[model samples]
Target chain A: MPVEDLYPSRNRTEPAILDRQDPIIHSTDFSAAPISEEQLRQYEEKGFLLLPEVFSRAEVSRFLNELNQMQQDQALLDSEVSITEPDSGALRSVFQIHHHNDLFSQVASDPRVADIARFILDDDLYIHQSRLNFKPGFNGREFYWHSDFETWHVEDGMPRMRALSASILLTDNSDFNGSLMVMPGSHRKYVSCAGETPDDYYRHSLQQQTVGTPDNHSLSYLHKQYGLESTAAPAGSVLLFDCNLMHGSNGNITPMPRSNLFFVYNAASNRCVAPFCNQPPRPEFLATRETFDILPQRSASQDRKAG
Target chain B: MPVEDLYPSRNRTEPAILDRQDPIIHSTDFSAAPISEEQLRQYEEKGFLLLPEVFSRAEVSRFLNELNQMQQDQALLDSEVSITEPDSGALRSVFQIHHHNDLFSQVASDPRVADIARFILDDDLYIHQSRLNFKPGFNGREFYWHSDFETWHVEDGMPRMRALSASILLTDNSDFNGSLMVMPGSHRKYVSCAGETPDDYYRHSLQQQTVGTPDNHSLSYLHKQYGLESTAAPAGSVLLFDCNLMHGSNGNITPMPRSNLFFVYNAASNRCVAPFCNQPPRPEFLATRETFDILPQRSASQDRKAG
Candidate 1:
């Protein structure tokens, strides 16, 4: 059935009631009532915002250390990563840490981050999923330039007021370090690039490259038309962008490894796609009060238990 | 970070591989070498089979009739049904019907409904996510049930392949009419039926009840026990069962409308988590030469019309 008929007819012109109001941005201290009008306008115009010092150095270090340990354990198990054999233009990378990690739980529940999400989403936020993006020093992969929302729409749908992604830099990022580059205001256009015939750059590399390979012409065109901007931030900075914004990062070029924690959040009511397994609740969906009670809390005694 | 690190270590064992000597099951004719010894063992033990079927009249009509005229016209817009709302569970209810439609590309491509998937899965077949279960009747709302999955430990982690669901009736299933009922497996085992608990009975009024509701005791108990089942069927049937095998259905007590087009398949891969949005391709990832050509065909058609 055509997608439209599945939904009841209503004022298509008026924005969906589900779309919350603009956030009330706070001061630079990352403390205020909500995202202020200024912040919301800037985000709408620029497509992304960098919130400063969202994670403490200690927290970042602890998570990284945990990840390093996890990797060692995995290697002992003789696990190996593989790319798609026939190639579906998808990217693949693995991180030592799993989504169920305690640090991940903290990251998901961090009020500072949640506040930003509330601002971006303009509604009570729920985490959709969390992942650690690890690029080893020599990994040549580059994330393709595209909007998260576009990718999400292929699975979710459009004009979502409740969805956004926060990328927390675990290491200092710069042009040399493969900091994310985004086409500002391009998110407003909400273009979907999947399944489209790749222009010259993509076609030539079809046999070797995966989905995230950069399309310079497309990026440049968007930049020229929309005044795109790239984000360079300190290790603790967190960047928030509408799921629909067009963004991606270059391959890691720095000598040090580049790692970032990505937390995806959506409005409380957003239905989640059933994961690959049976109808397990979405990770964020599983965070209901009842489920939360069962989760291991980050108590002071956790360290002793770990030891 | 290898995928193995995501789960705890278990005793080393050989990978569970499908028997190579088993005969190949094709989608056409639903004909295959008789169920192999291994396959029958798996099915009898697991309670499901993967058999493909060529589309027939009853299947197509049952699905098409459920859609409103508007939806029918929309189907013509793109030969495939498009589900835009991934978050809302409702979309699945609306779109899954396409899986049952004989004219639908996916069904047409592979007719033997559960046989091949069963062969690959090496387990009794259960409908994992039949695309056809999504169609809605004029009033909306349909089947309800309680089901759970069995658990197994694979190299990747603790994989739960327990419960499955089937969409047997294709006709409009309205709330006023009785829908499927599930006792929530083993509700009787619970000592106290508290407030806001789901009931073991099937009642349309209870459809929207939440977890703690008095009527939710059955659901809560089943959830606690991790077993629920639905055994509703019609001519062309689709049924899903948990690997652990604990679930049941309320009879089709209502008279609003009902039809059936069933699909049963098993998880091709053992991982129970949500699939990676961008998992690297694996050698076993199946893609026919026809896969790439399908898109180009559409592009060609669009080009011709524009010219």
Candidate 2:
């Protein structure tokens, strides 16, 4: 039998809330740098964990150089994988960077990154999606509040909440520089949003998502239950969050720009099926259903040791 | 356990030929128009069946208009989904037409087209890929000799031969106008080609495939065993062939252009997994690893009654 869509979101008349149907972690392997008991508790309660200075200054500089080169290349910028800000026409995001660039692929497979993901997901994993997000100063746009799994389950067929995102900051994120904000404990509840997803929705949704976002009532409910917490960290920090975490970022109006390399890892057992909303699945760059190979964790000492 | 790569082709040491591993016809459903015993025997023996003028002239004209409109739109042509002929710089192929156009989607699910696929595959179906192939009058290039399943299995993770291509001719295909040529009875043998599938191979392979073309030895062997037959049919004809058939077409040096609407339908049970070559799967436009919703058979009388 086809897996039931425990939490259906889009293409419906009304919004609903249900309990999350999957586990947060699927494995007990702690061979790598696993989180401590206290850290685990904090993540379980808050739905996110922020680690500071995970990379060295030199490494961050190299990432910035590669990102700058990609943005400056007119051909690369014009490709369909790159999306520019709607208002300012500045580079906003580049999808599938792990497949597009060698450095990013290495970063995706890096032990420091993948080990934590494996420990959290507790199973073999594949890259569900990867992107380099750029929030240019002045006219940078705000990402609306929504749960990643709401979109994934509706359009990409992700089966469960067994995925997490690792966002590596390439630029300093200040309070005024559009830092990411999350509603604490919201990941425990699944929010079903209203509206139907139009055909080829990703073409516009990637630039500005209107359909899968949370409604005002749901947002108010989440805000009232668990007040939002914003992360203001320096470059080289990494923020790991659950797939169903209700999160968004403000528009950057300060001089400091915000940029991050983001990678989403999904448990191999939780590979996608047909979309829950019965719509056509999004493109592979958004949610990969191709590969289910267990990611072989790289030896930690082979790359830069965490500070 | 992961399905073994039974017919591994690209990204290997040497070419090998194996017996066909899967069935030709999957279902015995005959509710819709079914192939007669003689026609079935002919398809089983020669691996292809060409229906003469399955569509009316008006329907063909509407398809031509849609194709022309899509080609004339500079923005659509500029999109990454459109590929230009390497030499002539004219539009050669437009992919994902079933999603890009409303008319084509209806055509895809139409009983006249999909019912035959359902009967042959003997299972619920999903479109693995769809495209509009345009061979401009003078400068159209030749597609190399190769089995469609070899590429689909190697790069798209298609596990079996229970798939077929439905080529709906938009223009009359004459002897000189770059009609598809197939090696009779070659579908029984799986030809494993020689070469590694480079990263992002589809970018170049779509326009001019060099890596996955069958070697001279295999092609010569197939040619000697089963002579090639060129499909020279009129407009509105539909050509159905097994996925593993050794097929290619010559360059159109004539003044008349040849275009066809091509759709590949795979059994629902045969959805893709990881690529056999261990490389990243091609983007969705080439090989869909997305939604596998069964194509609901449309009522025959709803569309034009078969001509």
Candidate 3:
């Protein structure tokens, strides 16, 4: 069977309103959030869900300390990572960070994120891939309109939309700074979108970002079907989006910076079978096949005792 | 004061035989390695030490799956990372992987490595940076000889030689494969080496690795003073070396692969203060400043209990 065997074709009419639970909107502490039926409905209905203020200011401060520290640590500064603007030379994204840092590792497998993924996937999970997307004030570039699944299926060999990406906001994403914009309910349309050669620097393709974002035909079709929705939330918000949902972000021309740490969770059975395109997938740090059990959530009291 | 104010000159007379505890070398199971005082002497005398067969075939198989999966995982392969040969489009190296995957994350912070760093620097530690150096058979290229500190101190504001790097072998680093070649005890020289711009594709420079490796003066000086040492071991062997050690690798012409996972550990107190060179430091993924508390070691029994 073809990888897209289950999905309705791009020519199919009337994209379905896949039903899911309501999003678990939380405040400052997600580990404590109960997984409710409402959240499942939100995931199914909108193809994305928002968990607002999942981390406290103190936690965000701690995250920033580590984020800035990597730039200041001499050993790391000398490493070769993805720096978007060579001229201004600010960070665009950093791949495979969980491999080295404890903070990233812990968060990537955080119970809250994992539980959400488990409910959506209905199977054991593995990290399909991960990255830190940065929009440093004035330097953050635009992420062209595109669906992640187009690339995930063609490049990474993901079979279906059984995976989802969760973004943990590291910095406040105001309107002025670039924010994620999604086409409402676009996940129902499975577009056999296009692909392009790798970029000279990061080798990335958005199917909508950079080189081969949606063409006039696809763009007009998407526009005709769905209106755009923007996610301009504060730091510590956890935004989860479906794999096939069409999304993009604008340029940050303002003085503020917006950064988010994203962890992509995949259903174990939906592991990459084979690359749909000719070329192989990216490096392991960016995408991993191993499925590790998420550590049991430590209650506030337990954490205090351990500390 | 210049960054060099704190450091002894290249002309410093005595190269202290800094001594410490023996290596807590382990086999496939990490909890198995017994830390002996003898390994410390080896590290002091040679400036690099080997932990042979630290992982088992089963563990290696798990690693290979994750490694290959990354290539098949389209999102990662599509990511903008530095590839060696844009012509063949093979992954040359991947930066900041510690940010992403679980296996890489756990191993990078495995107690064995942290204990080594704590012993060597005599202080709490932070991950300076991490990367996967891939020398996949024919496409693997040469890493010209250079001291890592040359770049760290001059470009990233590192004040001293208090860092060490550990390379966990992912593939069998046979004699034919491009294995690391080090000049023993070379860390003693605090050379003010040169620097270069990042490659158009890779976005990196070693002070020498990408730009100016070693001029004739330094190369000949090292050759005359010390002999080249090759770290050609099995897939599970780990080769730990000083950050200031003069080292490089040859290209892989033979059919063997010599890939390794490298983690650079820095003393928490030695966080980067300021950029010493003309340009600002590289992206945060390459260098981090946060000092994370190491989680207590998970014994084999504890792991089973948790499981």
lDDT tens per residue, model 2, B34-151: 6666666677788898988888899999999999899899988999889998866899999988878899987888787787787788888899999999997544566667799988
The sequence of per-residue lDDT tens digits that candidate 2 reaches over residues A149-256 is 888888999888999999999999865456887888999999888888888998899888889887767776787788768677899998989999998775543335
| Per-residue lDDT of candidate 1, residues A105-126 (tens digit) | 7766566666656545544555
TM-score of each: 0.37, 0.49, 0.44
B1-307: candidate 3 lDDT, tens digit per residue: 5445343222223222222222222122323224555666677667888888776677777877888877776777666543445456677666667767788877776765656665676656677778877776533565666678666765566776788898988898754445777778666654444433332311644211434344545655665566566677888777888887878665553335677788888777777867554566666667765434343443443212101
True contacts kept of each: 0.00, 0.00, 0.00
C-alpha RMSD (angstroms) for model 3: 25.1
Determine the TM-score of chain B of model 2.
0.96
DockQ of each: 0.01, 0.01, 0.01
lDDT of each: 0.41, 0.82, 0.62
Between the candidate structures 2 and 3, which one is better when assessed by lDDT?
Answer: 2
Docking class of 1: incorrect
lDDT score for residue A68 of model 3: 84
TM-score for chain A, candidates 1 onward in order: 0.66, 0.95, 0.80
> On residues A35-73, what C-alpha lDDT tens digit does candidate 3 reach at each position?
555665666666788787887788788888888877676
lDDT of 2 at B120: 83
Q: Alpha-carbon error at A305 in model 2, in Å?
A: 88
